[model samples]
Target: MREMVFEILTPREIEAKSMETITKELGGRTWPEPEFSIVKRCIHTSADFDYADNLCFSEDAAKIGVEALKNGADIVTDTKMAAAGINKNKLTSLGGEVHCYISDPDVVEEAKSRGCTRSTVCMERGAKLGKPTIFVIGNAPTALIELHRLINEEGLRPALIVGVPVGFVNVVESKELIMTDDMPYIVAKGRKGGSNIGAAIINAMLYTMGR
Candidate 1:
C-alpha cells in the first residue's frame, strides 16, 4: 500500500510554488527575470505556457509600467471585464483607479453616430482625461487603433499601453501599429491574448510596486 500525504499551503505559498514549477518546466529557455515573471504569471493565470514565447516587451516596458503605477497613473480598459479583473485594491493604494467607458451612454451614442465600435468612442472619451494614463486594452482591436490615431493625429500621449487584444480581425495589425510608435508598451504578440492577459499584465506591474 502506498502512503497518502496531504500538504496545505497559503495562497502566497501556492503562488510561489507555482512560479517555481513554471520556471523549472521552461528548462534551458530563459528571459530577463522581470519579463519572465510577467509571462510566468500569465501562464499561471491562463494555464497556457505558450505565453513564455508569445509575450514581448519594448526594452523598458516593465520599468515604464511600474513607474506609472508608482506615479498614480489612471488606468483605462476597453472592456468592463478587464476593468473588473484589475486589482483595484492595489491600484487604489497607488492612488490610481481602473476605468472602462464601454457601457457609457455617451460612448454608445457617439459610436452609433460615427458608425464605429463603442471601444473606439470609449478611447476617444477616456483619452481626454488629461492625466497620465495607462491603457490596458484586451478585447477590442478598434480601441487600440483609435488610441494610435489619437496619439499620432490628435496628439494624445499616454503614459504606457498594454495592448493584447485577442481576435482574428485587425488584431495583428493594431498591435503592429503600436509597436511602430515610440511609446512605452508591453505586448503579447500573435493572436493569443485577451482581457484576462491584459489585466494580468497590469496586476503584475502593481505587484512590482509592492501594491
Candidate 2:
C-alpha cells in the first residue's frame, strides 16, 4: 500500500511557494516590473500559466492604472461577485469605491425598456459617474461593447478598462475592440477570463501601490 503524505504549510507559506514555483517554471521568460506583478497574480489566482501569455496591456497601462488608483479612481464591475472579490479595504483607504450596478432597479428597468442587456445599461450608468473610474467587465460582452460605443460616440474615457470577459460569444471581439481603442487598458486577449481574473488584476494593482 502506498502511504499518504501531507505537506503542512500555512496559507502565506503556500502562496509564497506557489509564486516561487511559477517563477521557476517560467524559465528564462521575464516580465517588466508592474506587469510582472499583474501576470504573477493572474497566474496565482487561476493556476493557469496562460495568463502570462494572454494578458495584454496598452502602452503604460500598468502605470496608468496604478496612478488612477492612487488618485482615487472608483471601480465599476459588471458583477457583484467581482466587486466582492476586490480588496475593498485597500481601495477605500485609497479614497476609491467599488460598484456593481447590474442588479439596480433602474438599470433593470432601463434595459428592459430598451430591449438591451442590463450590462449595457450598467456601463451607461458607470459612465455617468463623472469621476475617474475604471471599468472591469469580466462577465458580459455587452458591457464591453457599450463601453466601446460610449468611448467612440459619447466620448466616455475611463481611467482603465479591464476587458476580460469569458465566453464564446462576443467576448473575444469585445476585447479586440478595447485593445484597438487608444485607452489605457489591461485585457486578456482570448475567451479565457472570468470575474476572478478581473478581481485579481485589480488586487494586483492595489498591492503594487503598497496598499
Candidate 3:
C-alpha cells in the first residue's frame, strides 16, 4: 500500500481551513451576505455544494431571522437532533432558547388521538407559545403543512420558518406550500436537507449576529 499522509490540525484550524477551501471552490459565485453565510455553513456541514444553489430564501428572510434572534425569539425544531446541534450558549446569550417537543407526552398523545404525526402536534404546541418564534423543521413534512395551516387559518405568524426536511414523501410539496405564503422563510427547494441543515442555518444567523 502507498504511504498515507494526513495533516494534523486543531479543531478550530480544521474548521477554518475547511471554510477557506469551500470559499475557494465556490469560485465566482457571489452570494450576498447573510444568505452567503447560511449557504456556506450548510455546505460545510454536509460537504455538498448543492446547498449553495438549493437554498431558497424569502425576501429579507435572513435579516428578519437575525433580528428575531437578537430580540430573544425562541426557536422550535421538529427534531431533537436539530435542537441539540444549535449552539445553546450562543443562543442563550442572545436571550433565546431552542425547543423540540416531538417527544413530549402531550404531543404524542395528541397525535395518537388525532391520527396525525407527532411533528404535526408539535407545531400546534409551538404555535400556542404565543411568543416570537422561529420554527426550524428538518425531518417532518407534516410539520410544515400544519405550520402553513396555522399561519393561514389561525393567524400564527412565526418570526421565521426554516423548512428543510429531507425525504421523498411530501417534502417538496411542504416546502412549496410554505413558500406560497408571504411568511419569512429559508427553505431547501428540493428534498436535500436534514436536521443538521436546519441547525446550521440557525447557527449561521446567530454567528452573523455576533452571538
Candidate 4:
C-alpha cells in the first residue's frame, strides 16, 4: 500500500473552496435568487447536496425572515446546540437574540408532569414570549407539532418557522403540517435535518443580511 498524504487547510480557505465547488456543480441551474443563495449555504454547511431537492420555502419566507431580523426579532430553537451554533455576533448586530429553553428546569418539570417532551413545552413557552419571533425546530418533531397547535388553536403567530427536525418518527408529518399553515416557513422535506441544519438555515439568513 502507498503511504497516505494529508494536507491541512484554514477554515476560511476550506469554506471558500466549498462555495466554489457548489457554484460550479450547480452548472447554470437557475434557483430562485436570494433564497437559493441561503439554500446553497445550508448545503455547504451539511455537505448534503440533497438539500437542493429537499428544502422547501414558503413564498415569503426569506423576505419575512430578513425583515424580522432587521427589525429586531427574537429567535427560539428547540435545542441548545442549535442556539449555540447560530452566529451570535451577526444576530446581535441585527438586534436579535437566540433562545433555547429545552433544558430549563421549569421546562423539564412541565414535560414530566404533562407526559410530553421538553421540546413541546419549550415551544409553547416561546410562542407566548411575543411576536416577530423565529422558531428553529431541528431536532424534535414534537416541537414542530406544538408550534402548529399554537398557531392554529392558540393563535400564536410567529415571524417565521424553520422546521427541519430530522427523524423517522413524525418528522415528515410535522413538516407537512407546517407547509399547510398560512405562515412563512423554511422546511426540509422528508427526514433529513438536525440541530446543525437548523442553525445553518438561520445563519444563512444572517449572513445574507450582514453582507
Candidate 5:
C-alpha cells in the first residue's frame, strides 16, 4: 500500500487573514491580561454556529484533542504512530484546518498517500501574546538557560517560540519548559526530538484543529 501526499502550505501567506480575534485569544491564554477577559456577544438571531470548523484526526488522537481543548489548549500536537495512527471517520466530522507539520515533506506526503497518516495541519495561529522568542541547545541545562532568557527578556508574558532540534539532545529541556516553565504562550518544537524530530513535534501541534 502507498501513502497519501501531505499538502504543504507555507506559513508566509497566513499573516493576511482576519486573525485579529484568534491572535488576541491566543495571547490572552498565555498572558493573564485583563483585556482578554472581555467577552463579545454576537446576537445571531438567525445565524447558527457550530463546531464544524475544527479539523479531525484519529479516534484516540481526536479523543485526546477534545480533552486538550477542554484542558485549555488552543492547539493539539501529535505524531502519527506508524501506518494508521489516526482515524478518518471522525475526521469527516471536522472542518476548519488540520495542521500536520513534518520535518521532511517527502515522508509526510508518502504517509498521507498510503493512508498511513491521513492528517492535516490545522492552519490556525494562536493569538500572539508577544514576539517570537528563541530557544537554543537541546539538553536540559541549555533549555533551562534559554527559558531563563525568555523570562528575563519578556517576563513570562505571552510568547511564540519555535521548539526545533528536539530529541535526546534537548527535548528534556524543551519538555521541561513546556510542561513546567512560566512562559505563557504557544511553542512549536521541530519534528521529533531528533532527526526529523522538529517536524514530529510540529506535526503533533498541527493536527490540533482549533475549535
Candidate 6:
C-alpha cells in the first residue's frame, strides 16, 4: 500500500515546487539556514491566514508547538518566527510568549542574534507522544475517519489540530489522529495544504490565552 501512494510528486515536481516556493520567499537573499527553507514552506503552505494578522512559526516543532498554540500557545517554537512572516510582535505585544525551541548551539547563537530568549529542543522537551502530540503527518494515505480511531483508542485528543494533510505522505492519516470531542479543528483540501496552516489555531489560541 505504501508503494501505491505518493506517486504524484514524480520527484521532479516536488523539487520544482519546493525550489520555486523557496526562491520566491527568499527574494535573492541567501537562506539564513538551508533546512529552514523546508520549514518556511511548510509553515506558509499549511497556515490559513495572512501573516499580517496574528501568526507564529513553529518550525519543525510544528507537532508540539501547533497543539500548544491551538491551546493558547503564545510560545512560538522557533526564534526566526518573525522571519517566517508571522505577525510575531502582534502576538508578543498582546502578551503571548514565544518559546523558541532550538537544538543546535550554533542555531541558539543565531537565535540570540535574532533576539530570542526562550527556546528548547526535542531532546530537551522530550518526544511528545500519546494522541494529542501533533506529529504534522502530511498527505498520508489513511483518511480522517480511521485516524480518529487511533486517537479514540489511544486517547489522544489534543486541544487543537490543523489537520491539513497533503501530498502522498501519510499526513492525512496523521492529521485524523485527534479530536474525539469535536475539539477545535482546521483542515485544508487534501493535498492543498501543509504544516504552517496550523498557525491559525496557534494564533487563535494565543489571542484567547492572552485575553
Candidate 6, residues 110-171, lDDT tens digits: the string is: 54675632232221221233223332222222324433544465554533344544466654
The alpha-carbon deviation from the true structure for residue 199 of candidate 1, after best TM-score superposition, in angstroms, is 0.6
Of candidates 6 and 2, the better by TM-score: 2
Candidate maximizing TM-score: 3
TM-score of candidate 2 against the unseen true structure: 0.95
Clashes of each: 0, 0, 0, 0, 49, 23
In order, the Cα lDDT scores of the candidates are 0.87, 0.92, 0.94, 0.88, 0.30, 0.40
> TM-score for every candidate vs. truth?
0.94, 0.95, 0.96, 0.93, 0.26, 0.36
Q: Top lDDT: which candidate number?
A: 3
Query: How high a TM-score does candidate 4 get?
Result: 0.93
Report the C-alpha lDDT of model 5 over 1-211, residue by residue, as the tens digit.
9989964655533422323444453444331212111111000110111111211111233233333333433221233321122233333344212223333476457656765431221111112222222221122233334444545664543222223333455554544455354443222232233213222222333244431
Candidate 6, residue 203: the lDDT equals 43
Supply the TM-score for candidate 1: 0.94
Global local distance difference test of model 2: 0.92
For candidate 5, the per-residue lDDT at 149 reads 50
What alpha-carbon RMSD in Å does predicted model 4 have with respect to the real structure? 2.1
Candidate 5: where are CA atoms >4 Å away? 1-144, 156-179, 184-192, 207-211
Using TM-score, rank the candidates from best to worst. 3, 2, 1, 4, 6, 5
The model with the greater TM-score, 1 or 3, is 3
**Candidate 1 clashes between residue pairs 3 or more apart in a chain or in different chains:** none
Candidate 2 colliding pairs, count? 0
Off by over 4 Å in 6: 1-72, 75-83, 100-158, 179-182, 200-211
Candidate 6 C-alpha error for residue 102, in Å:
6.5
Model 2 lDDT tens row, 105-156:
9989999999999999999989999999999998999999999999999999
The residue ranges of model 1 lying beyond 4 angstroms of the native Cα positions read 1-6
lDDT over C-alpha atoms for residue 93 of model 1: 85
Q: For residues 142-205, could you state the per-residue lDDT of candidate 1 as single tens digits?
A: 9889998999999888898999999899998899999888888888888989999998988888
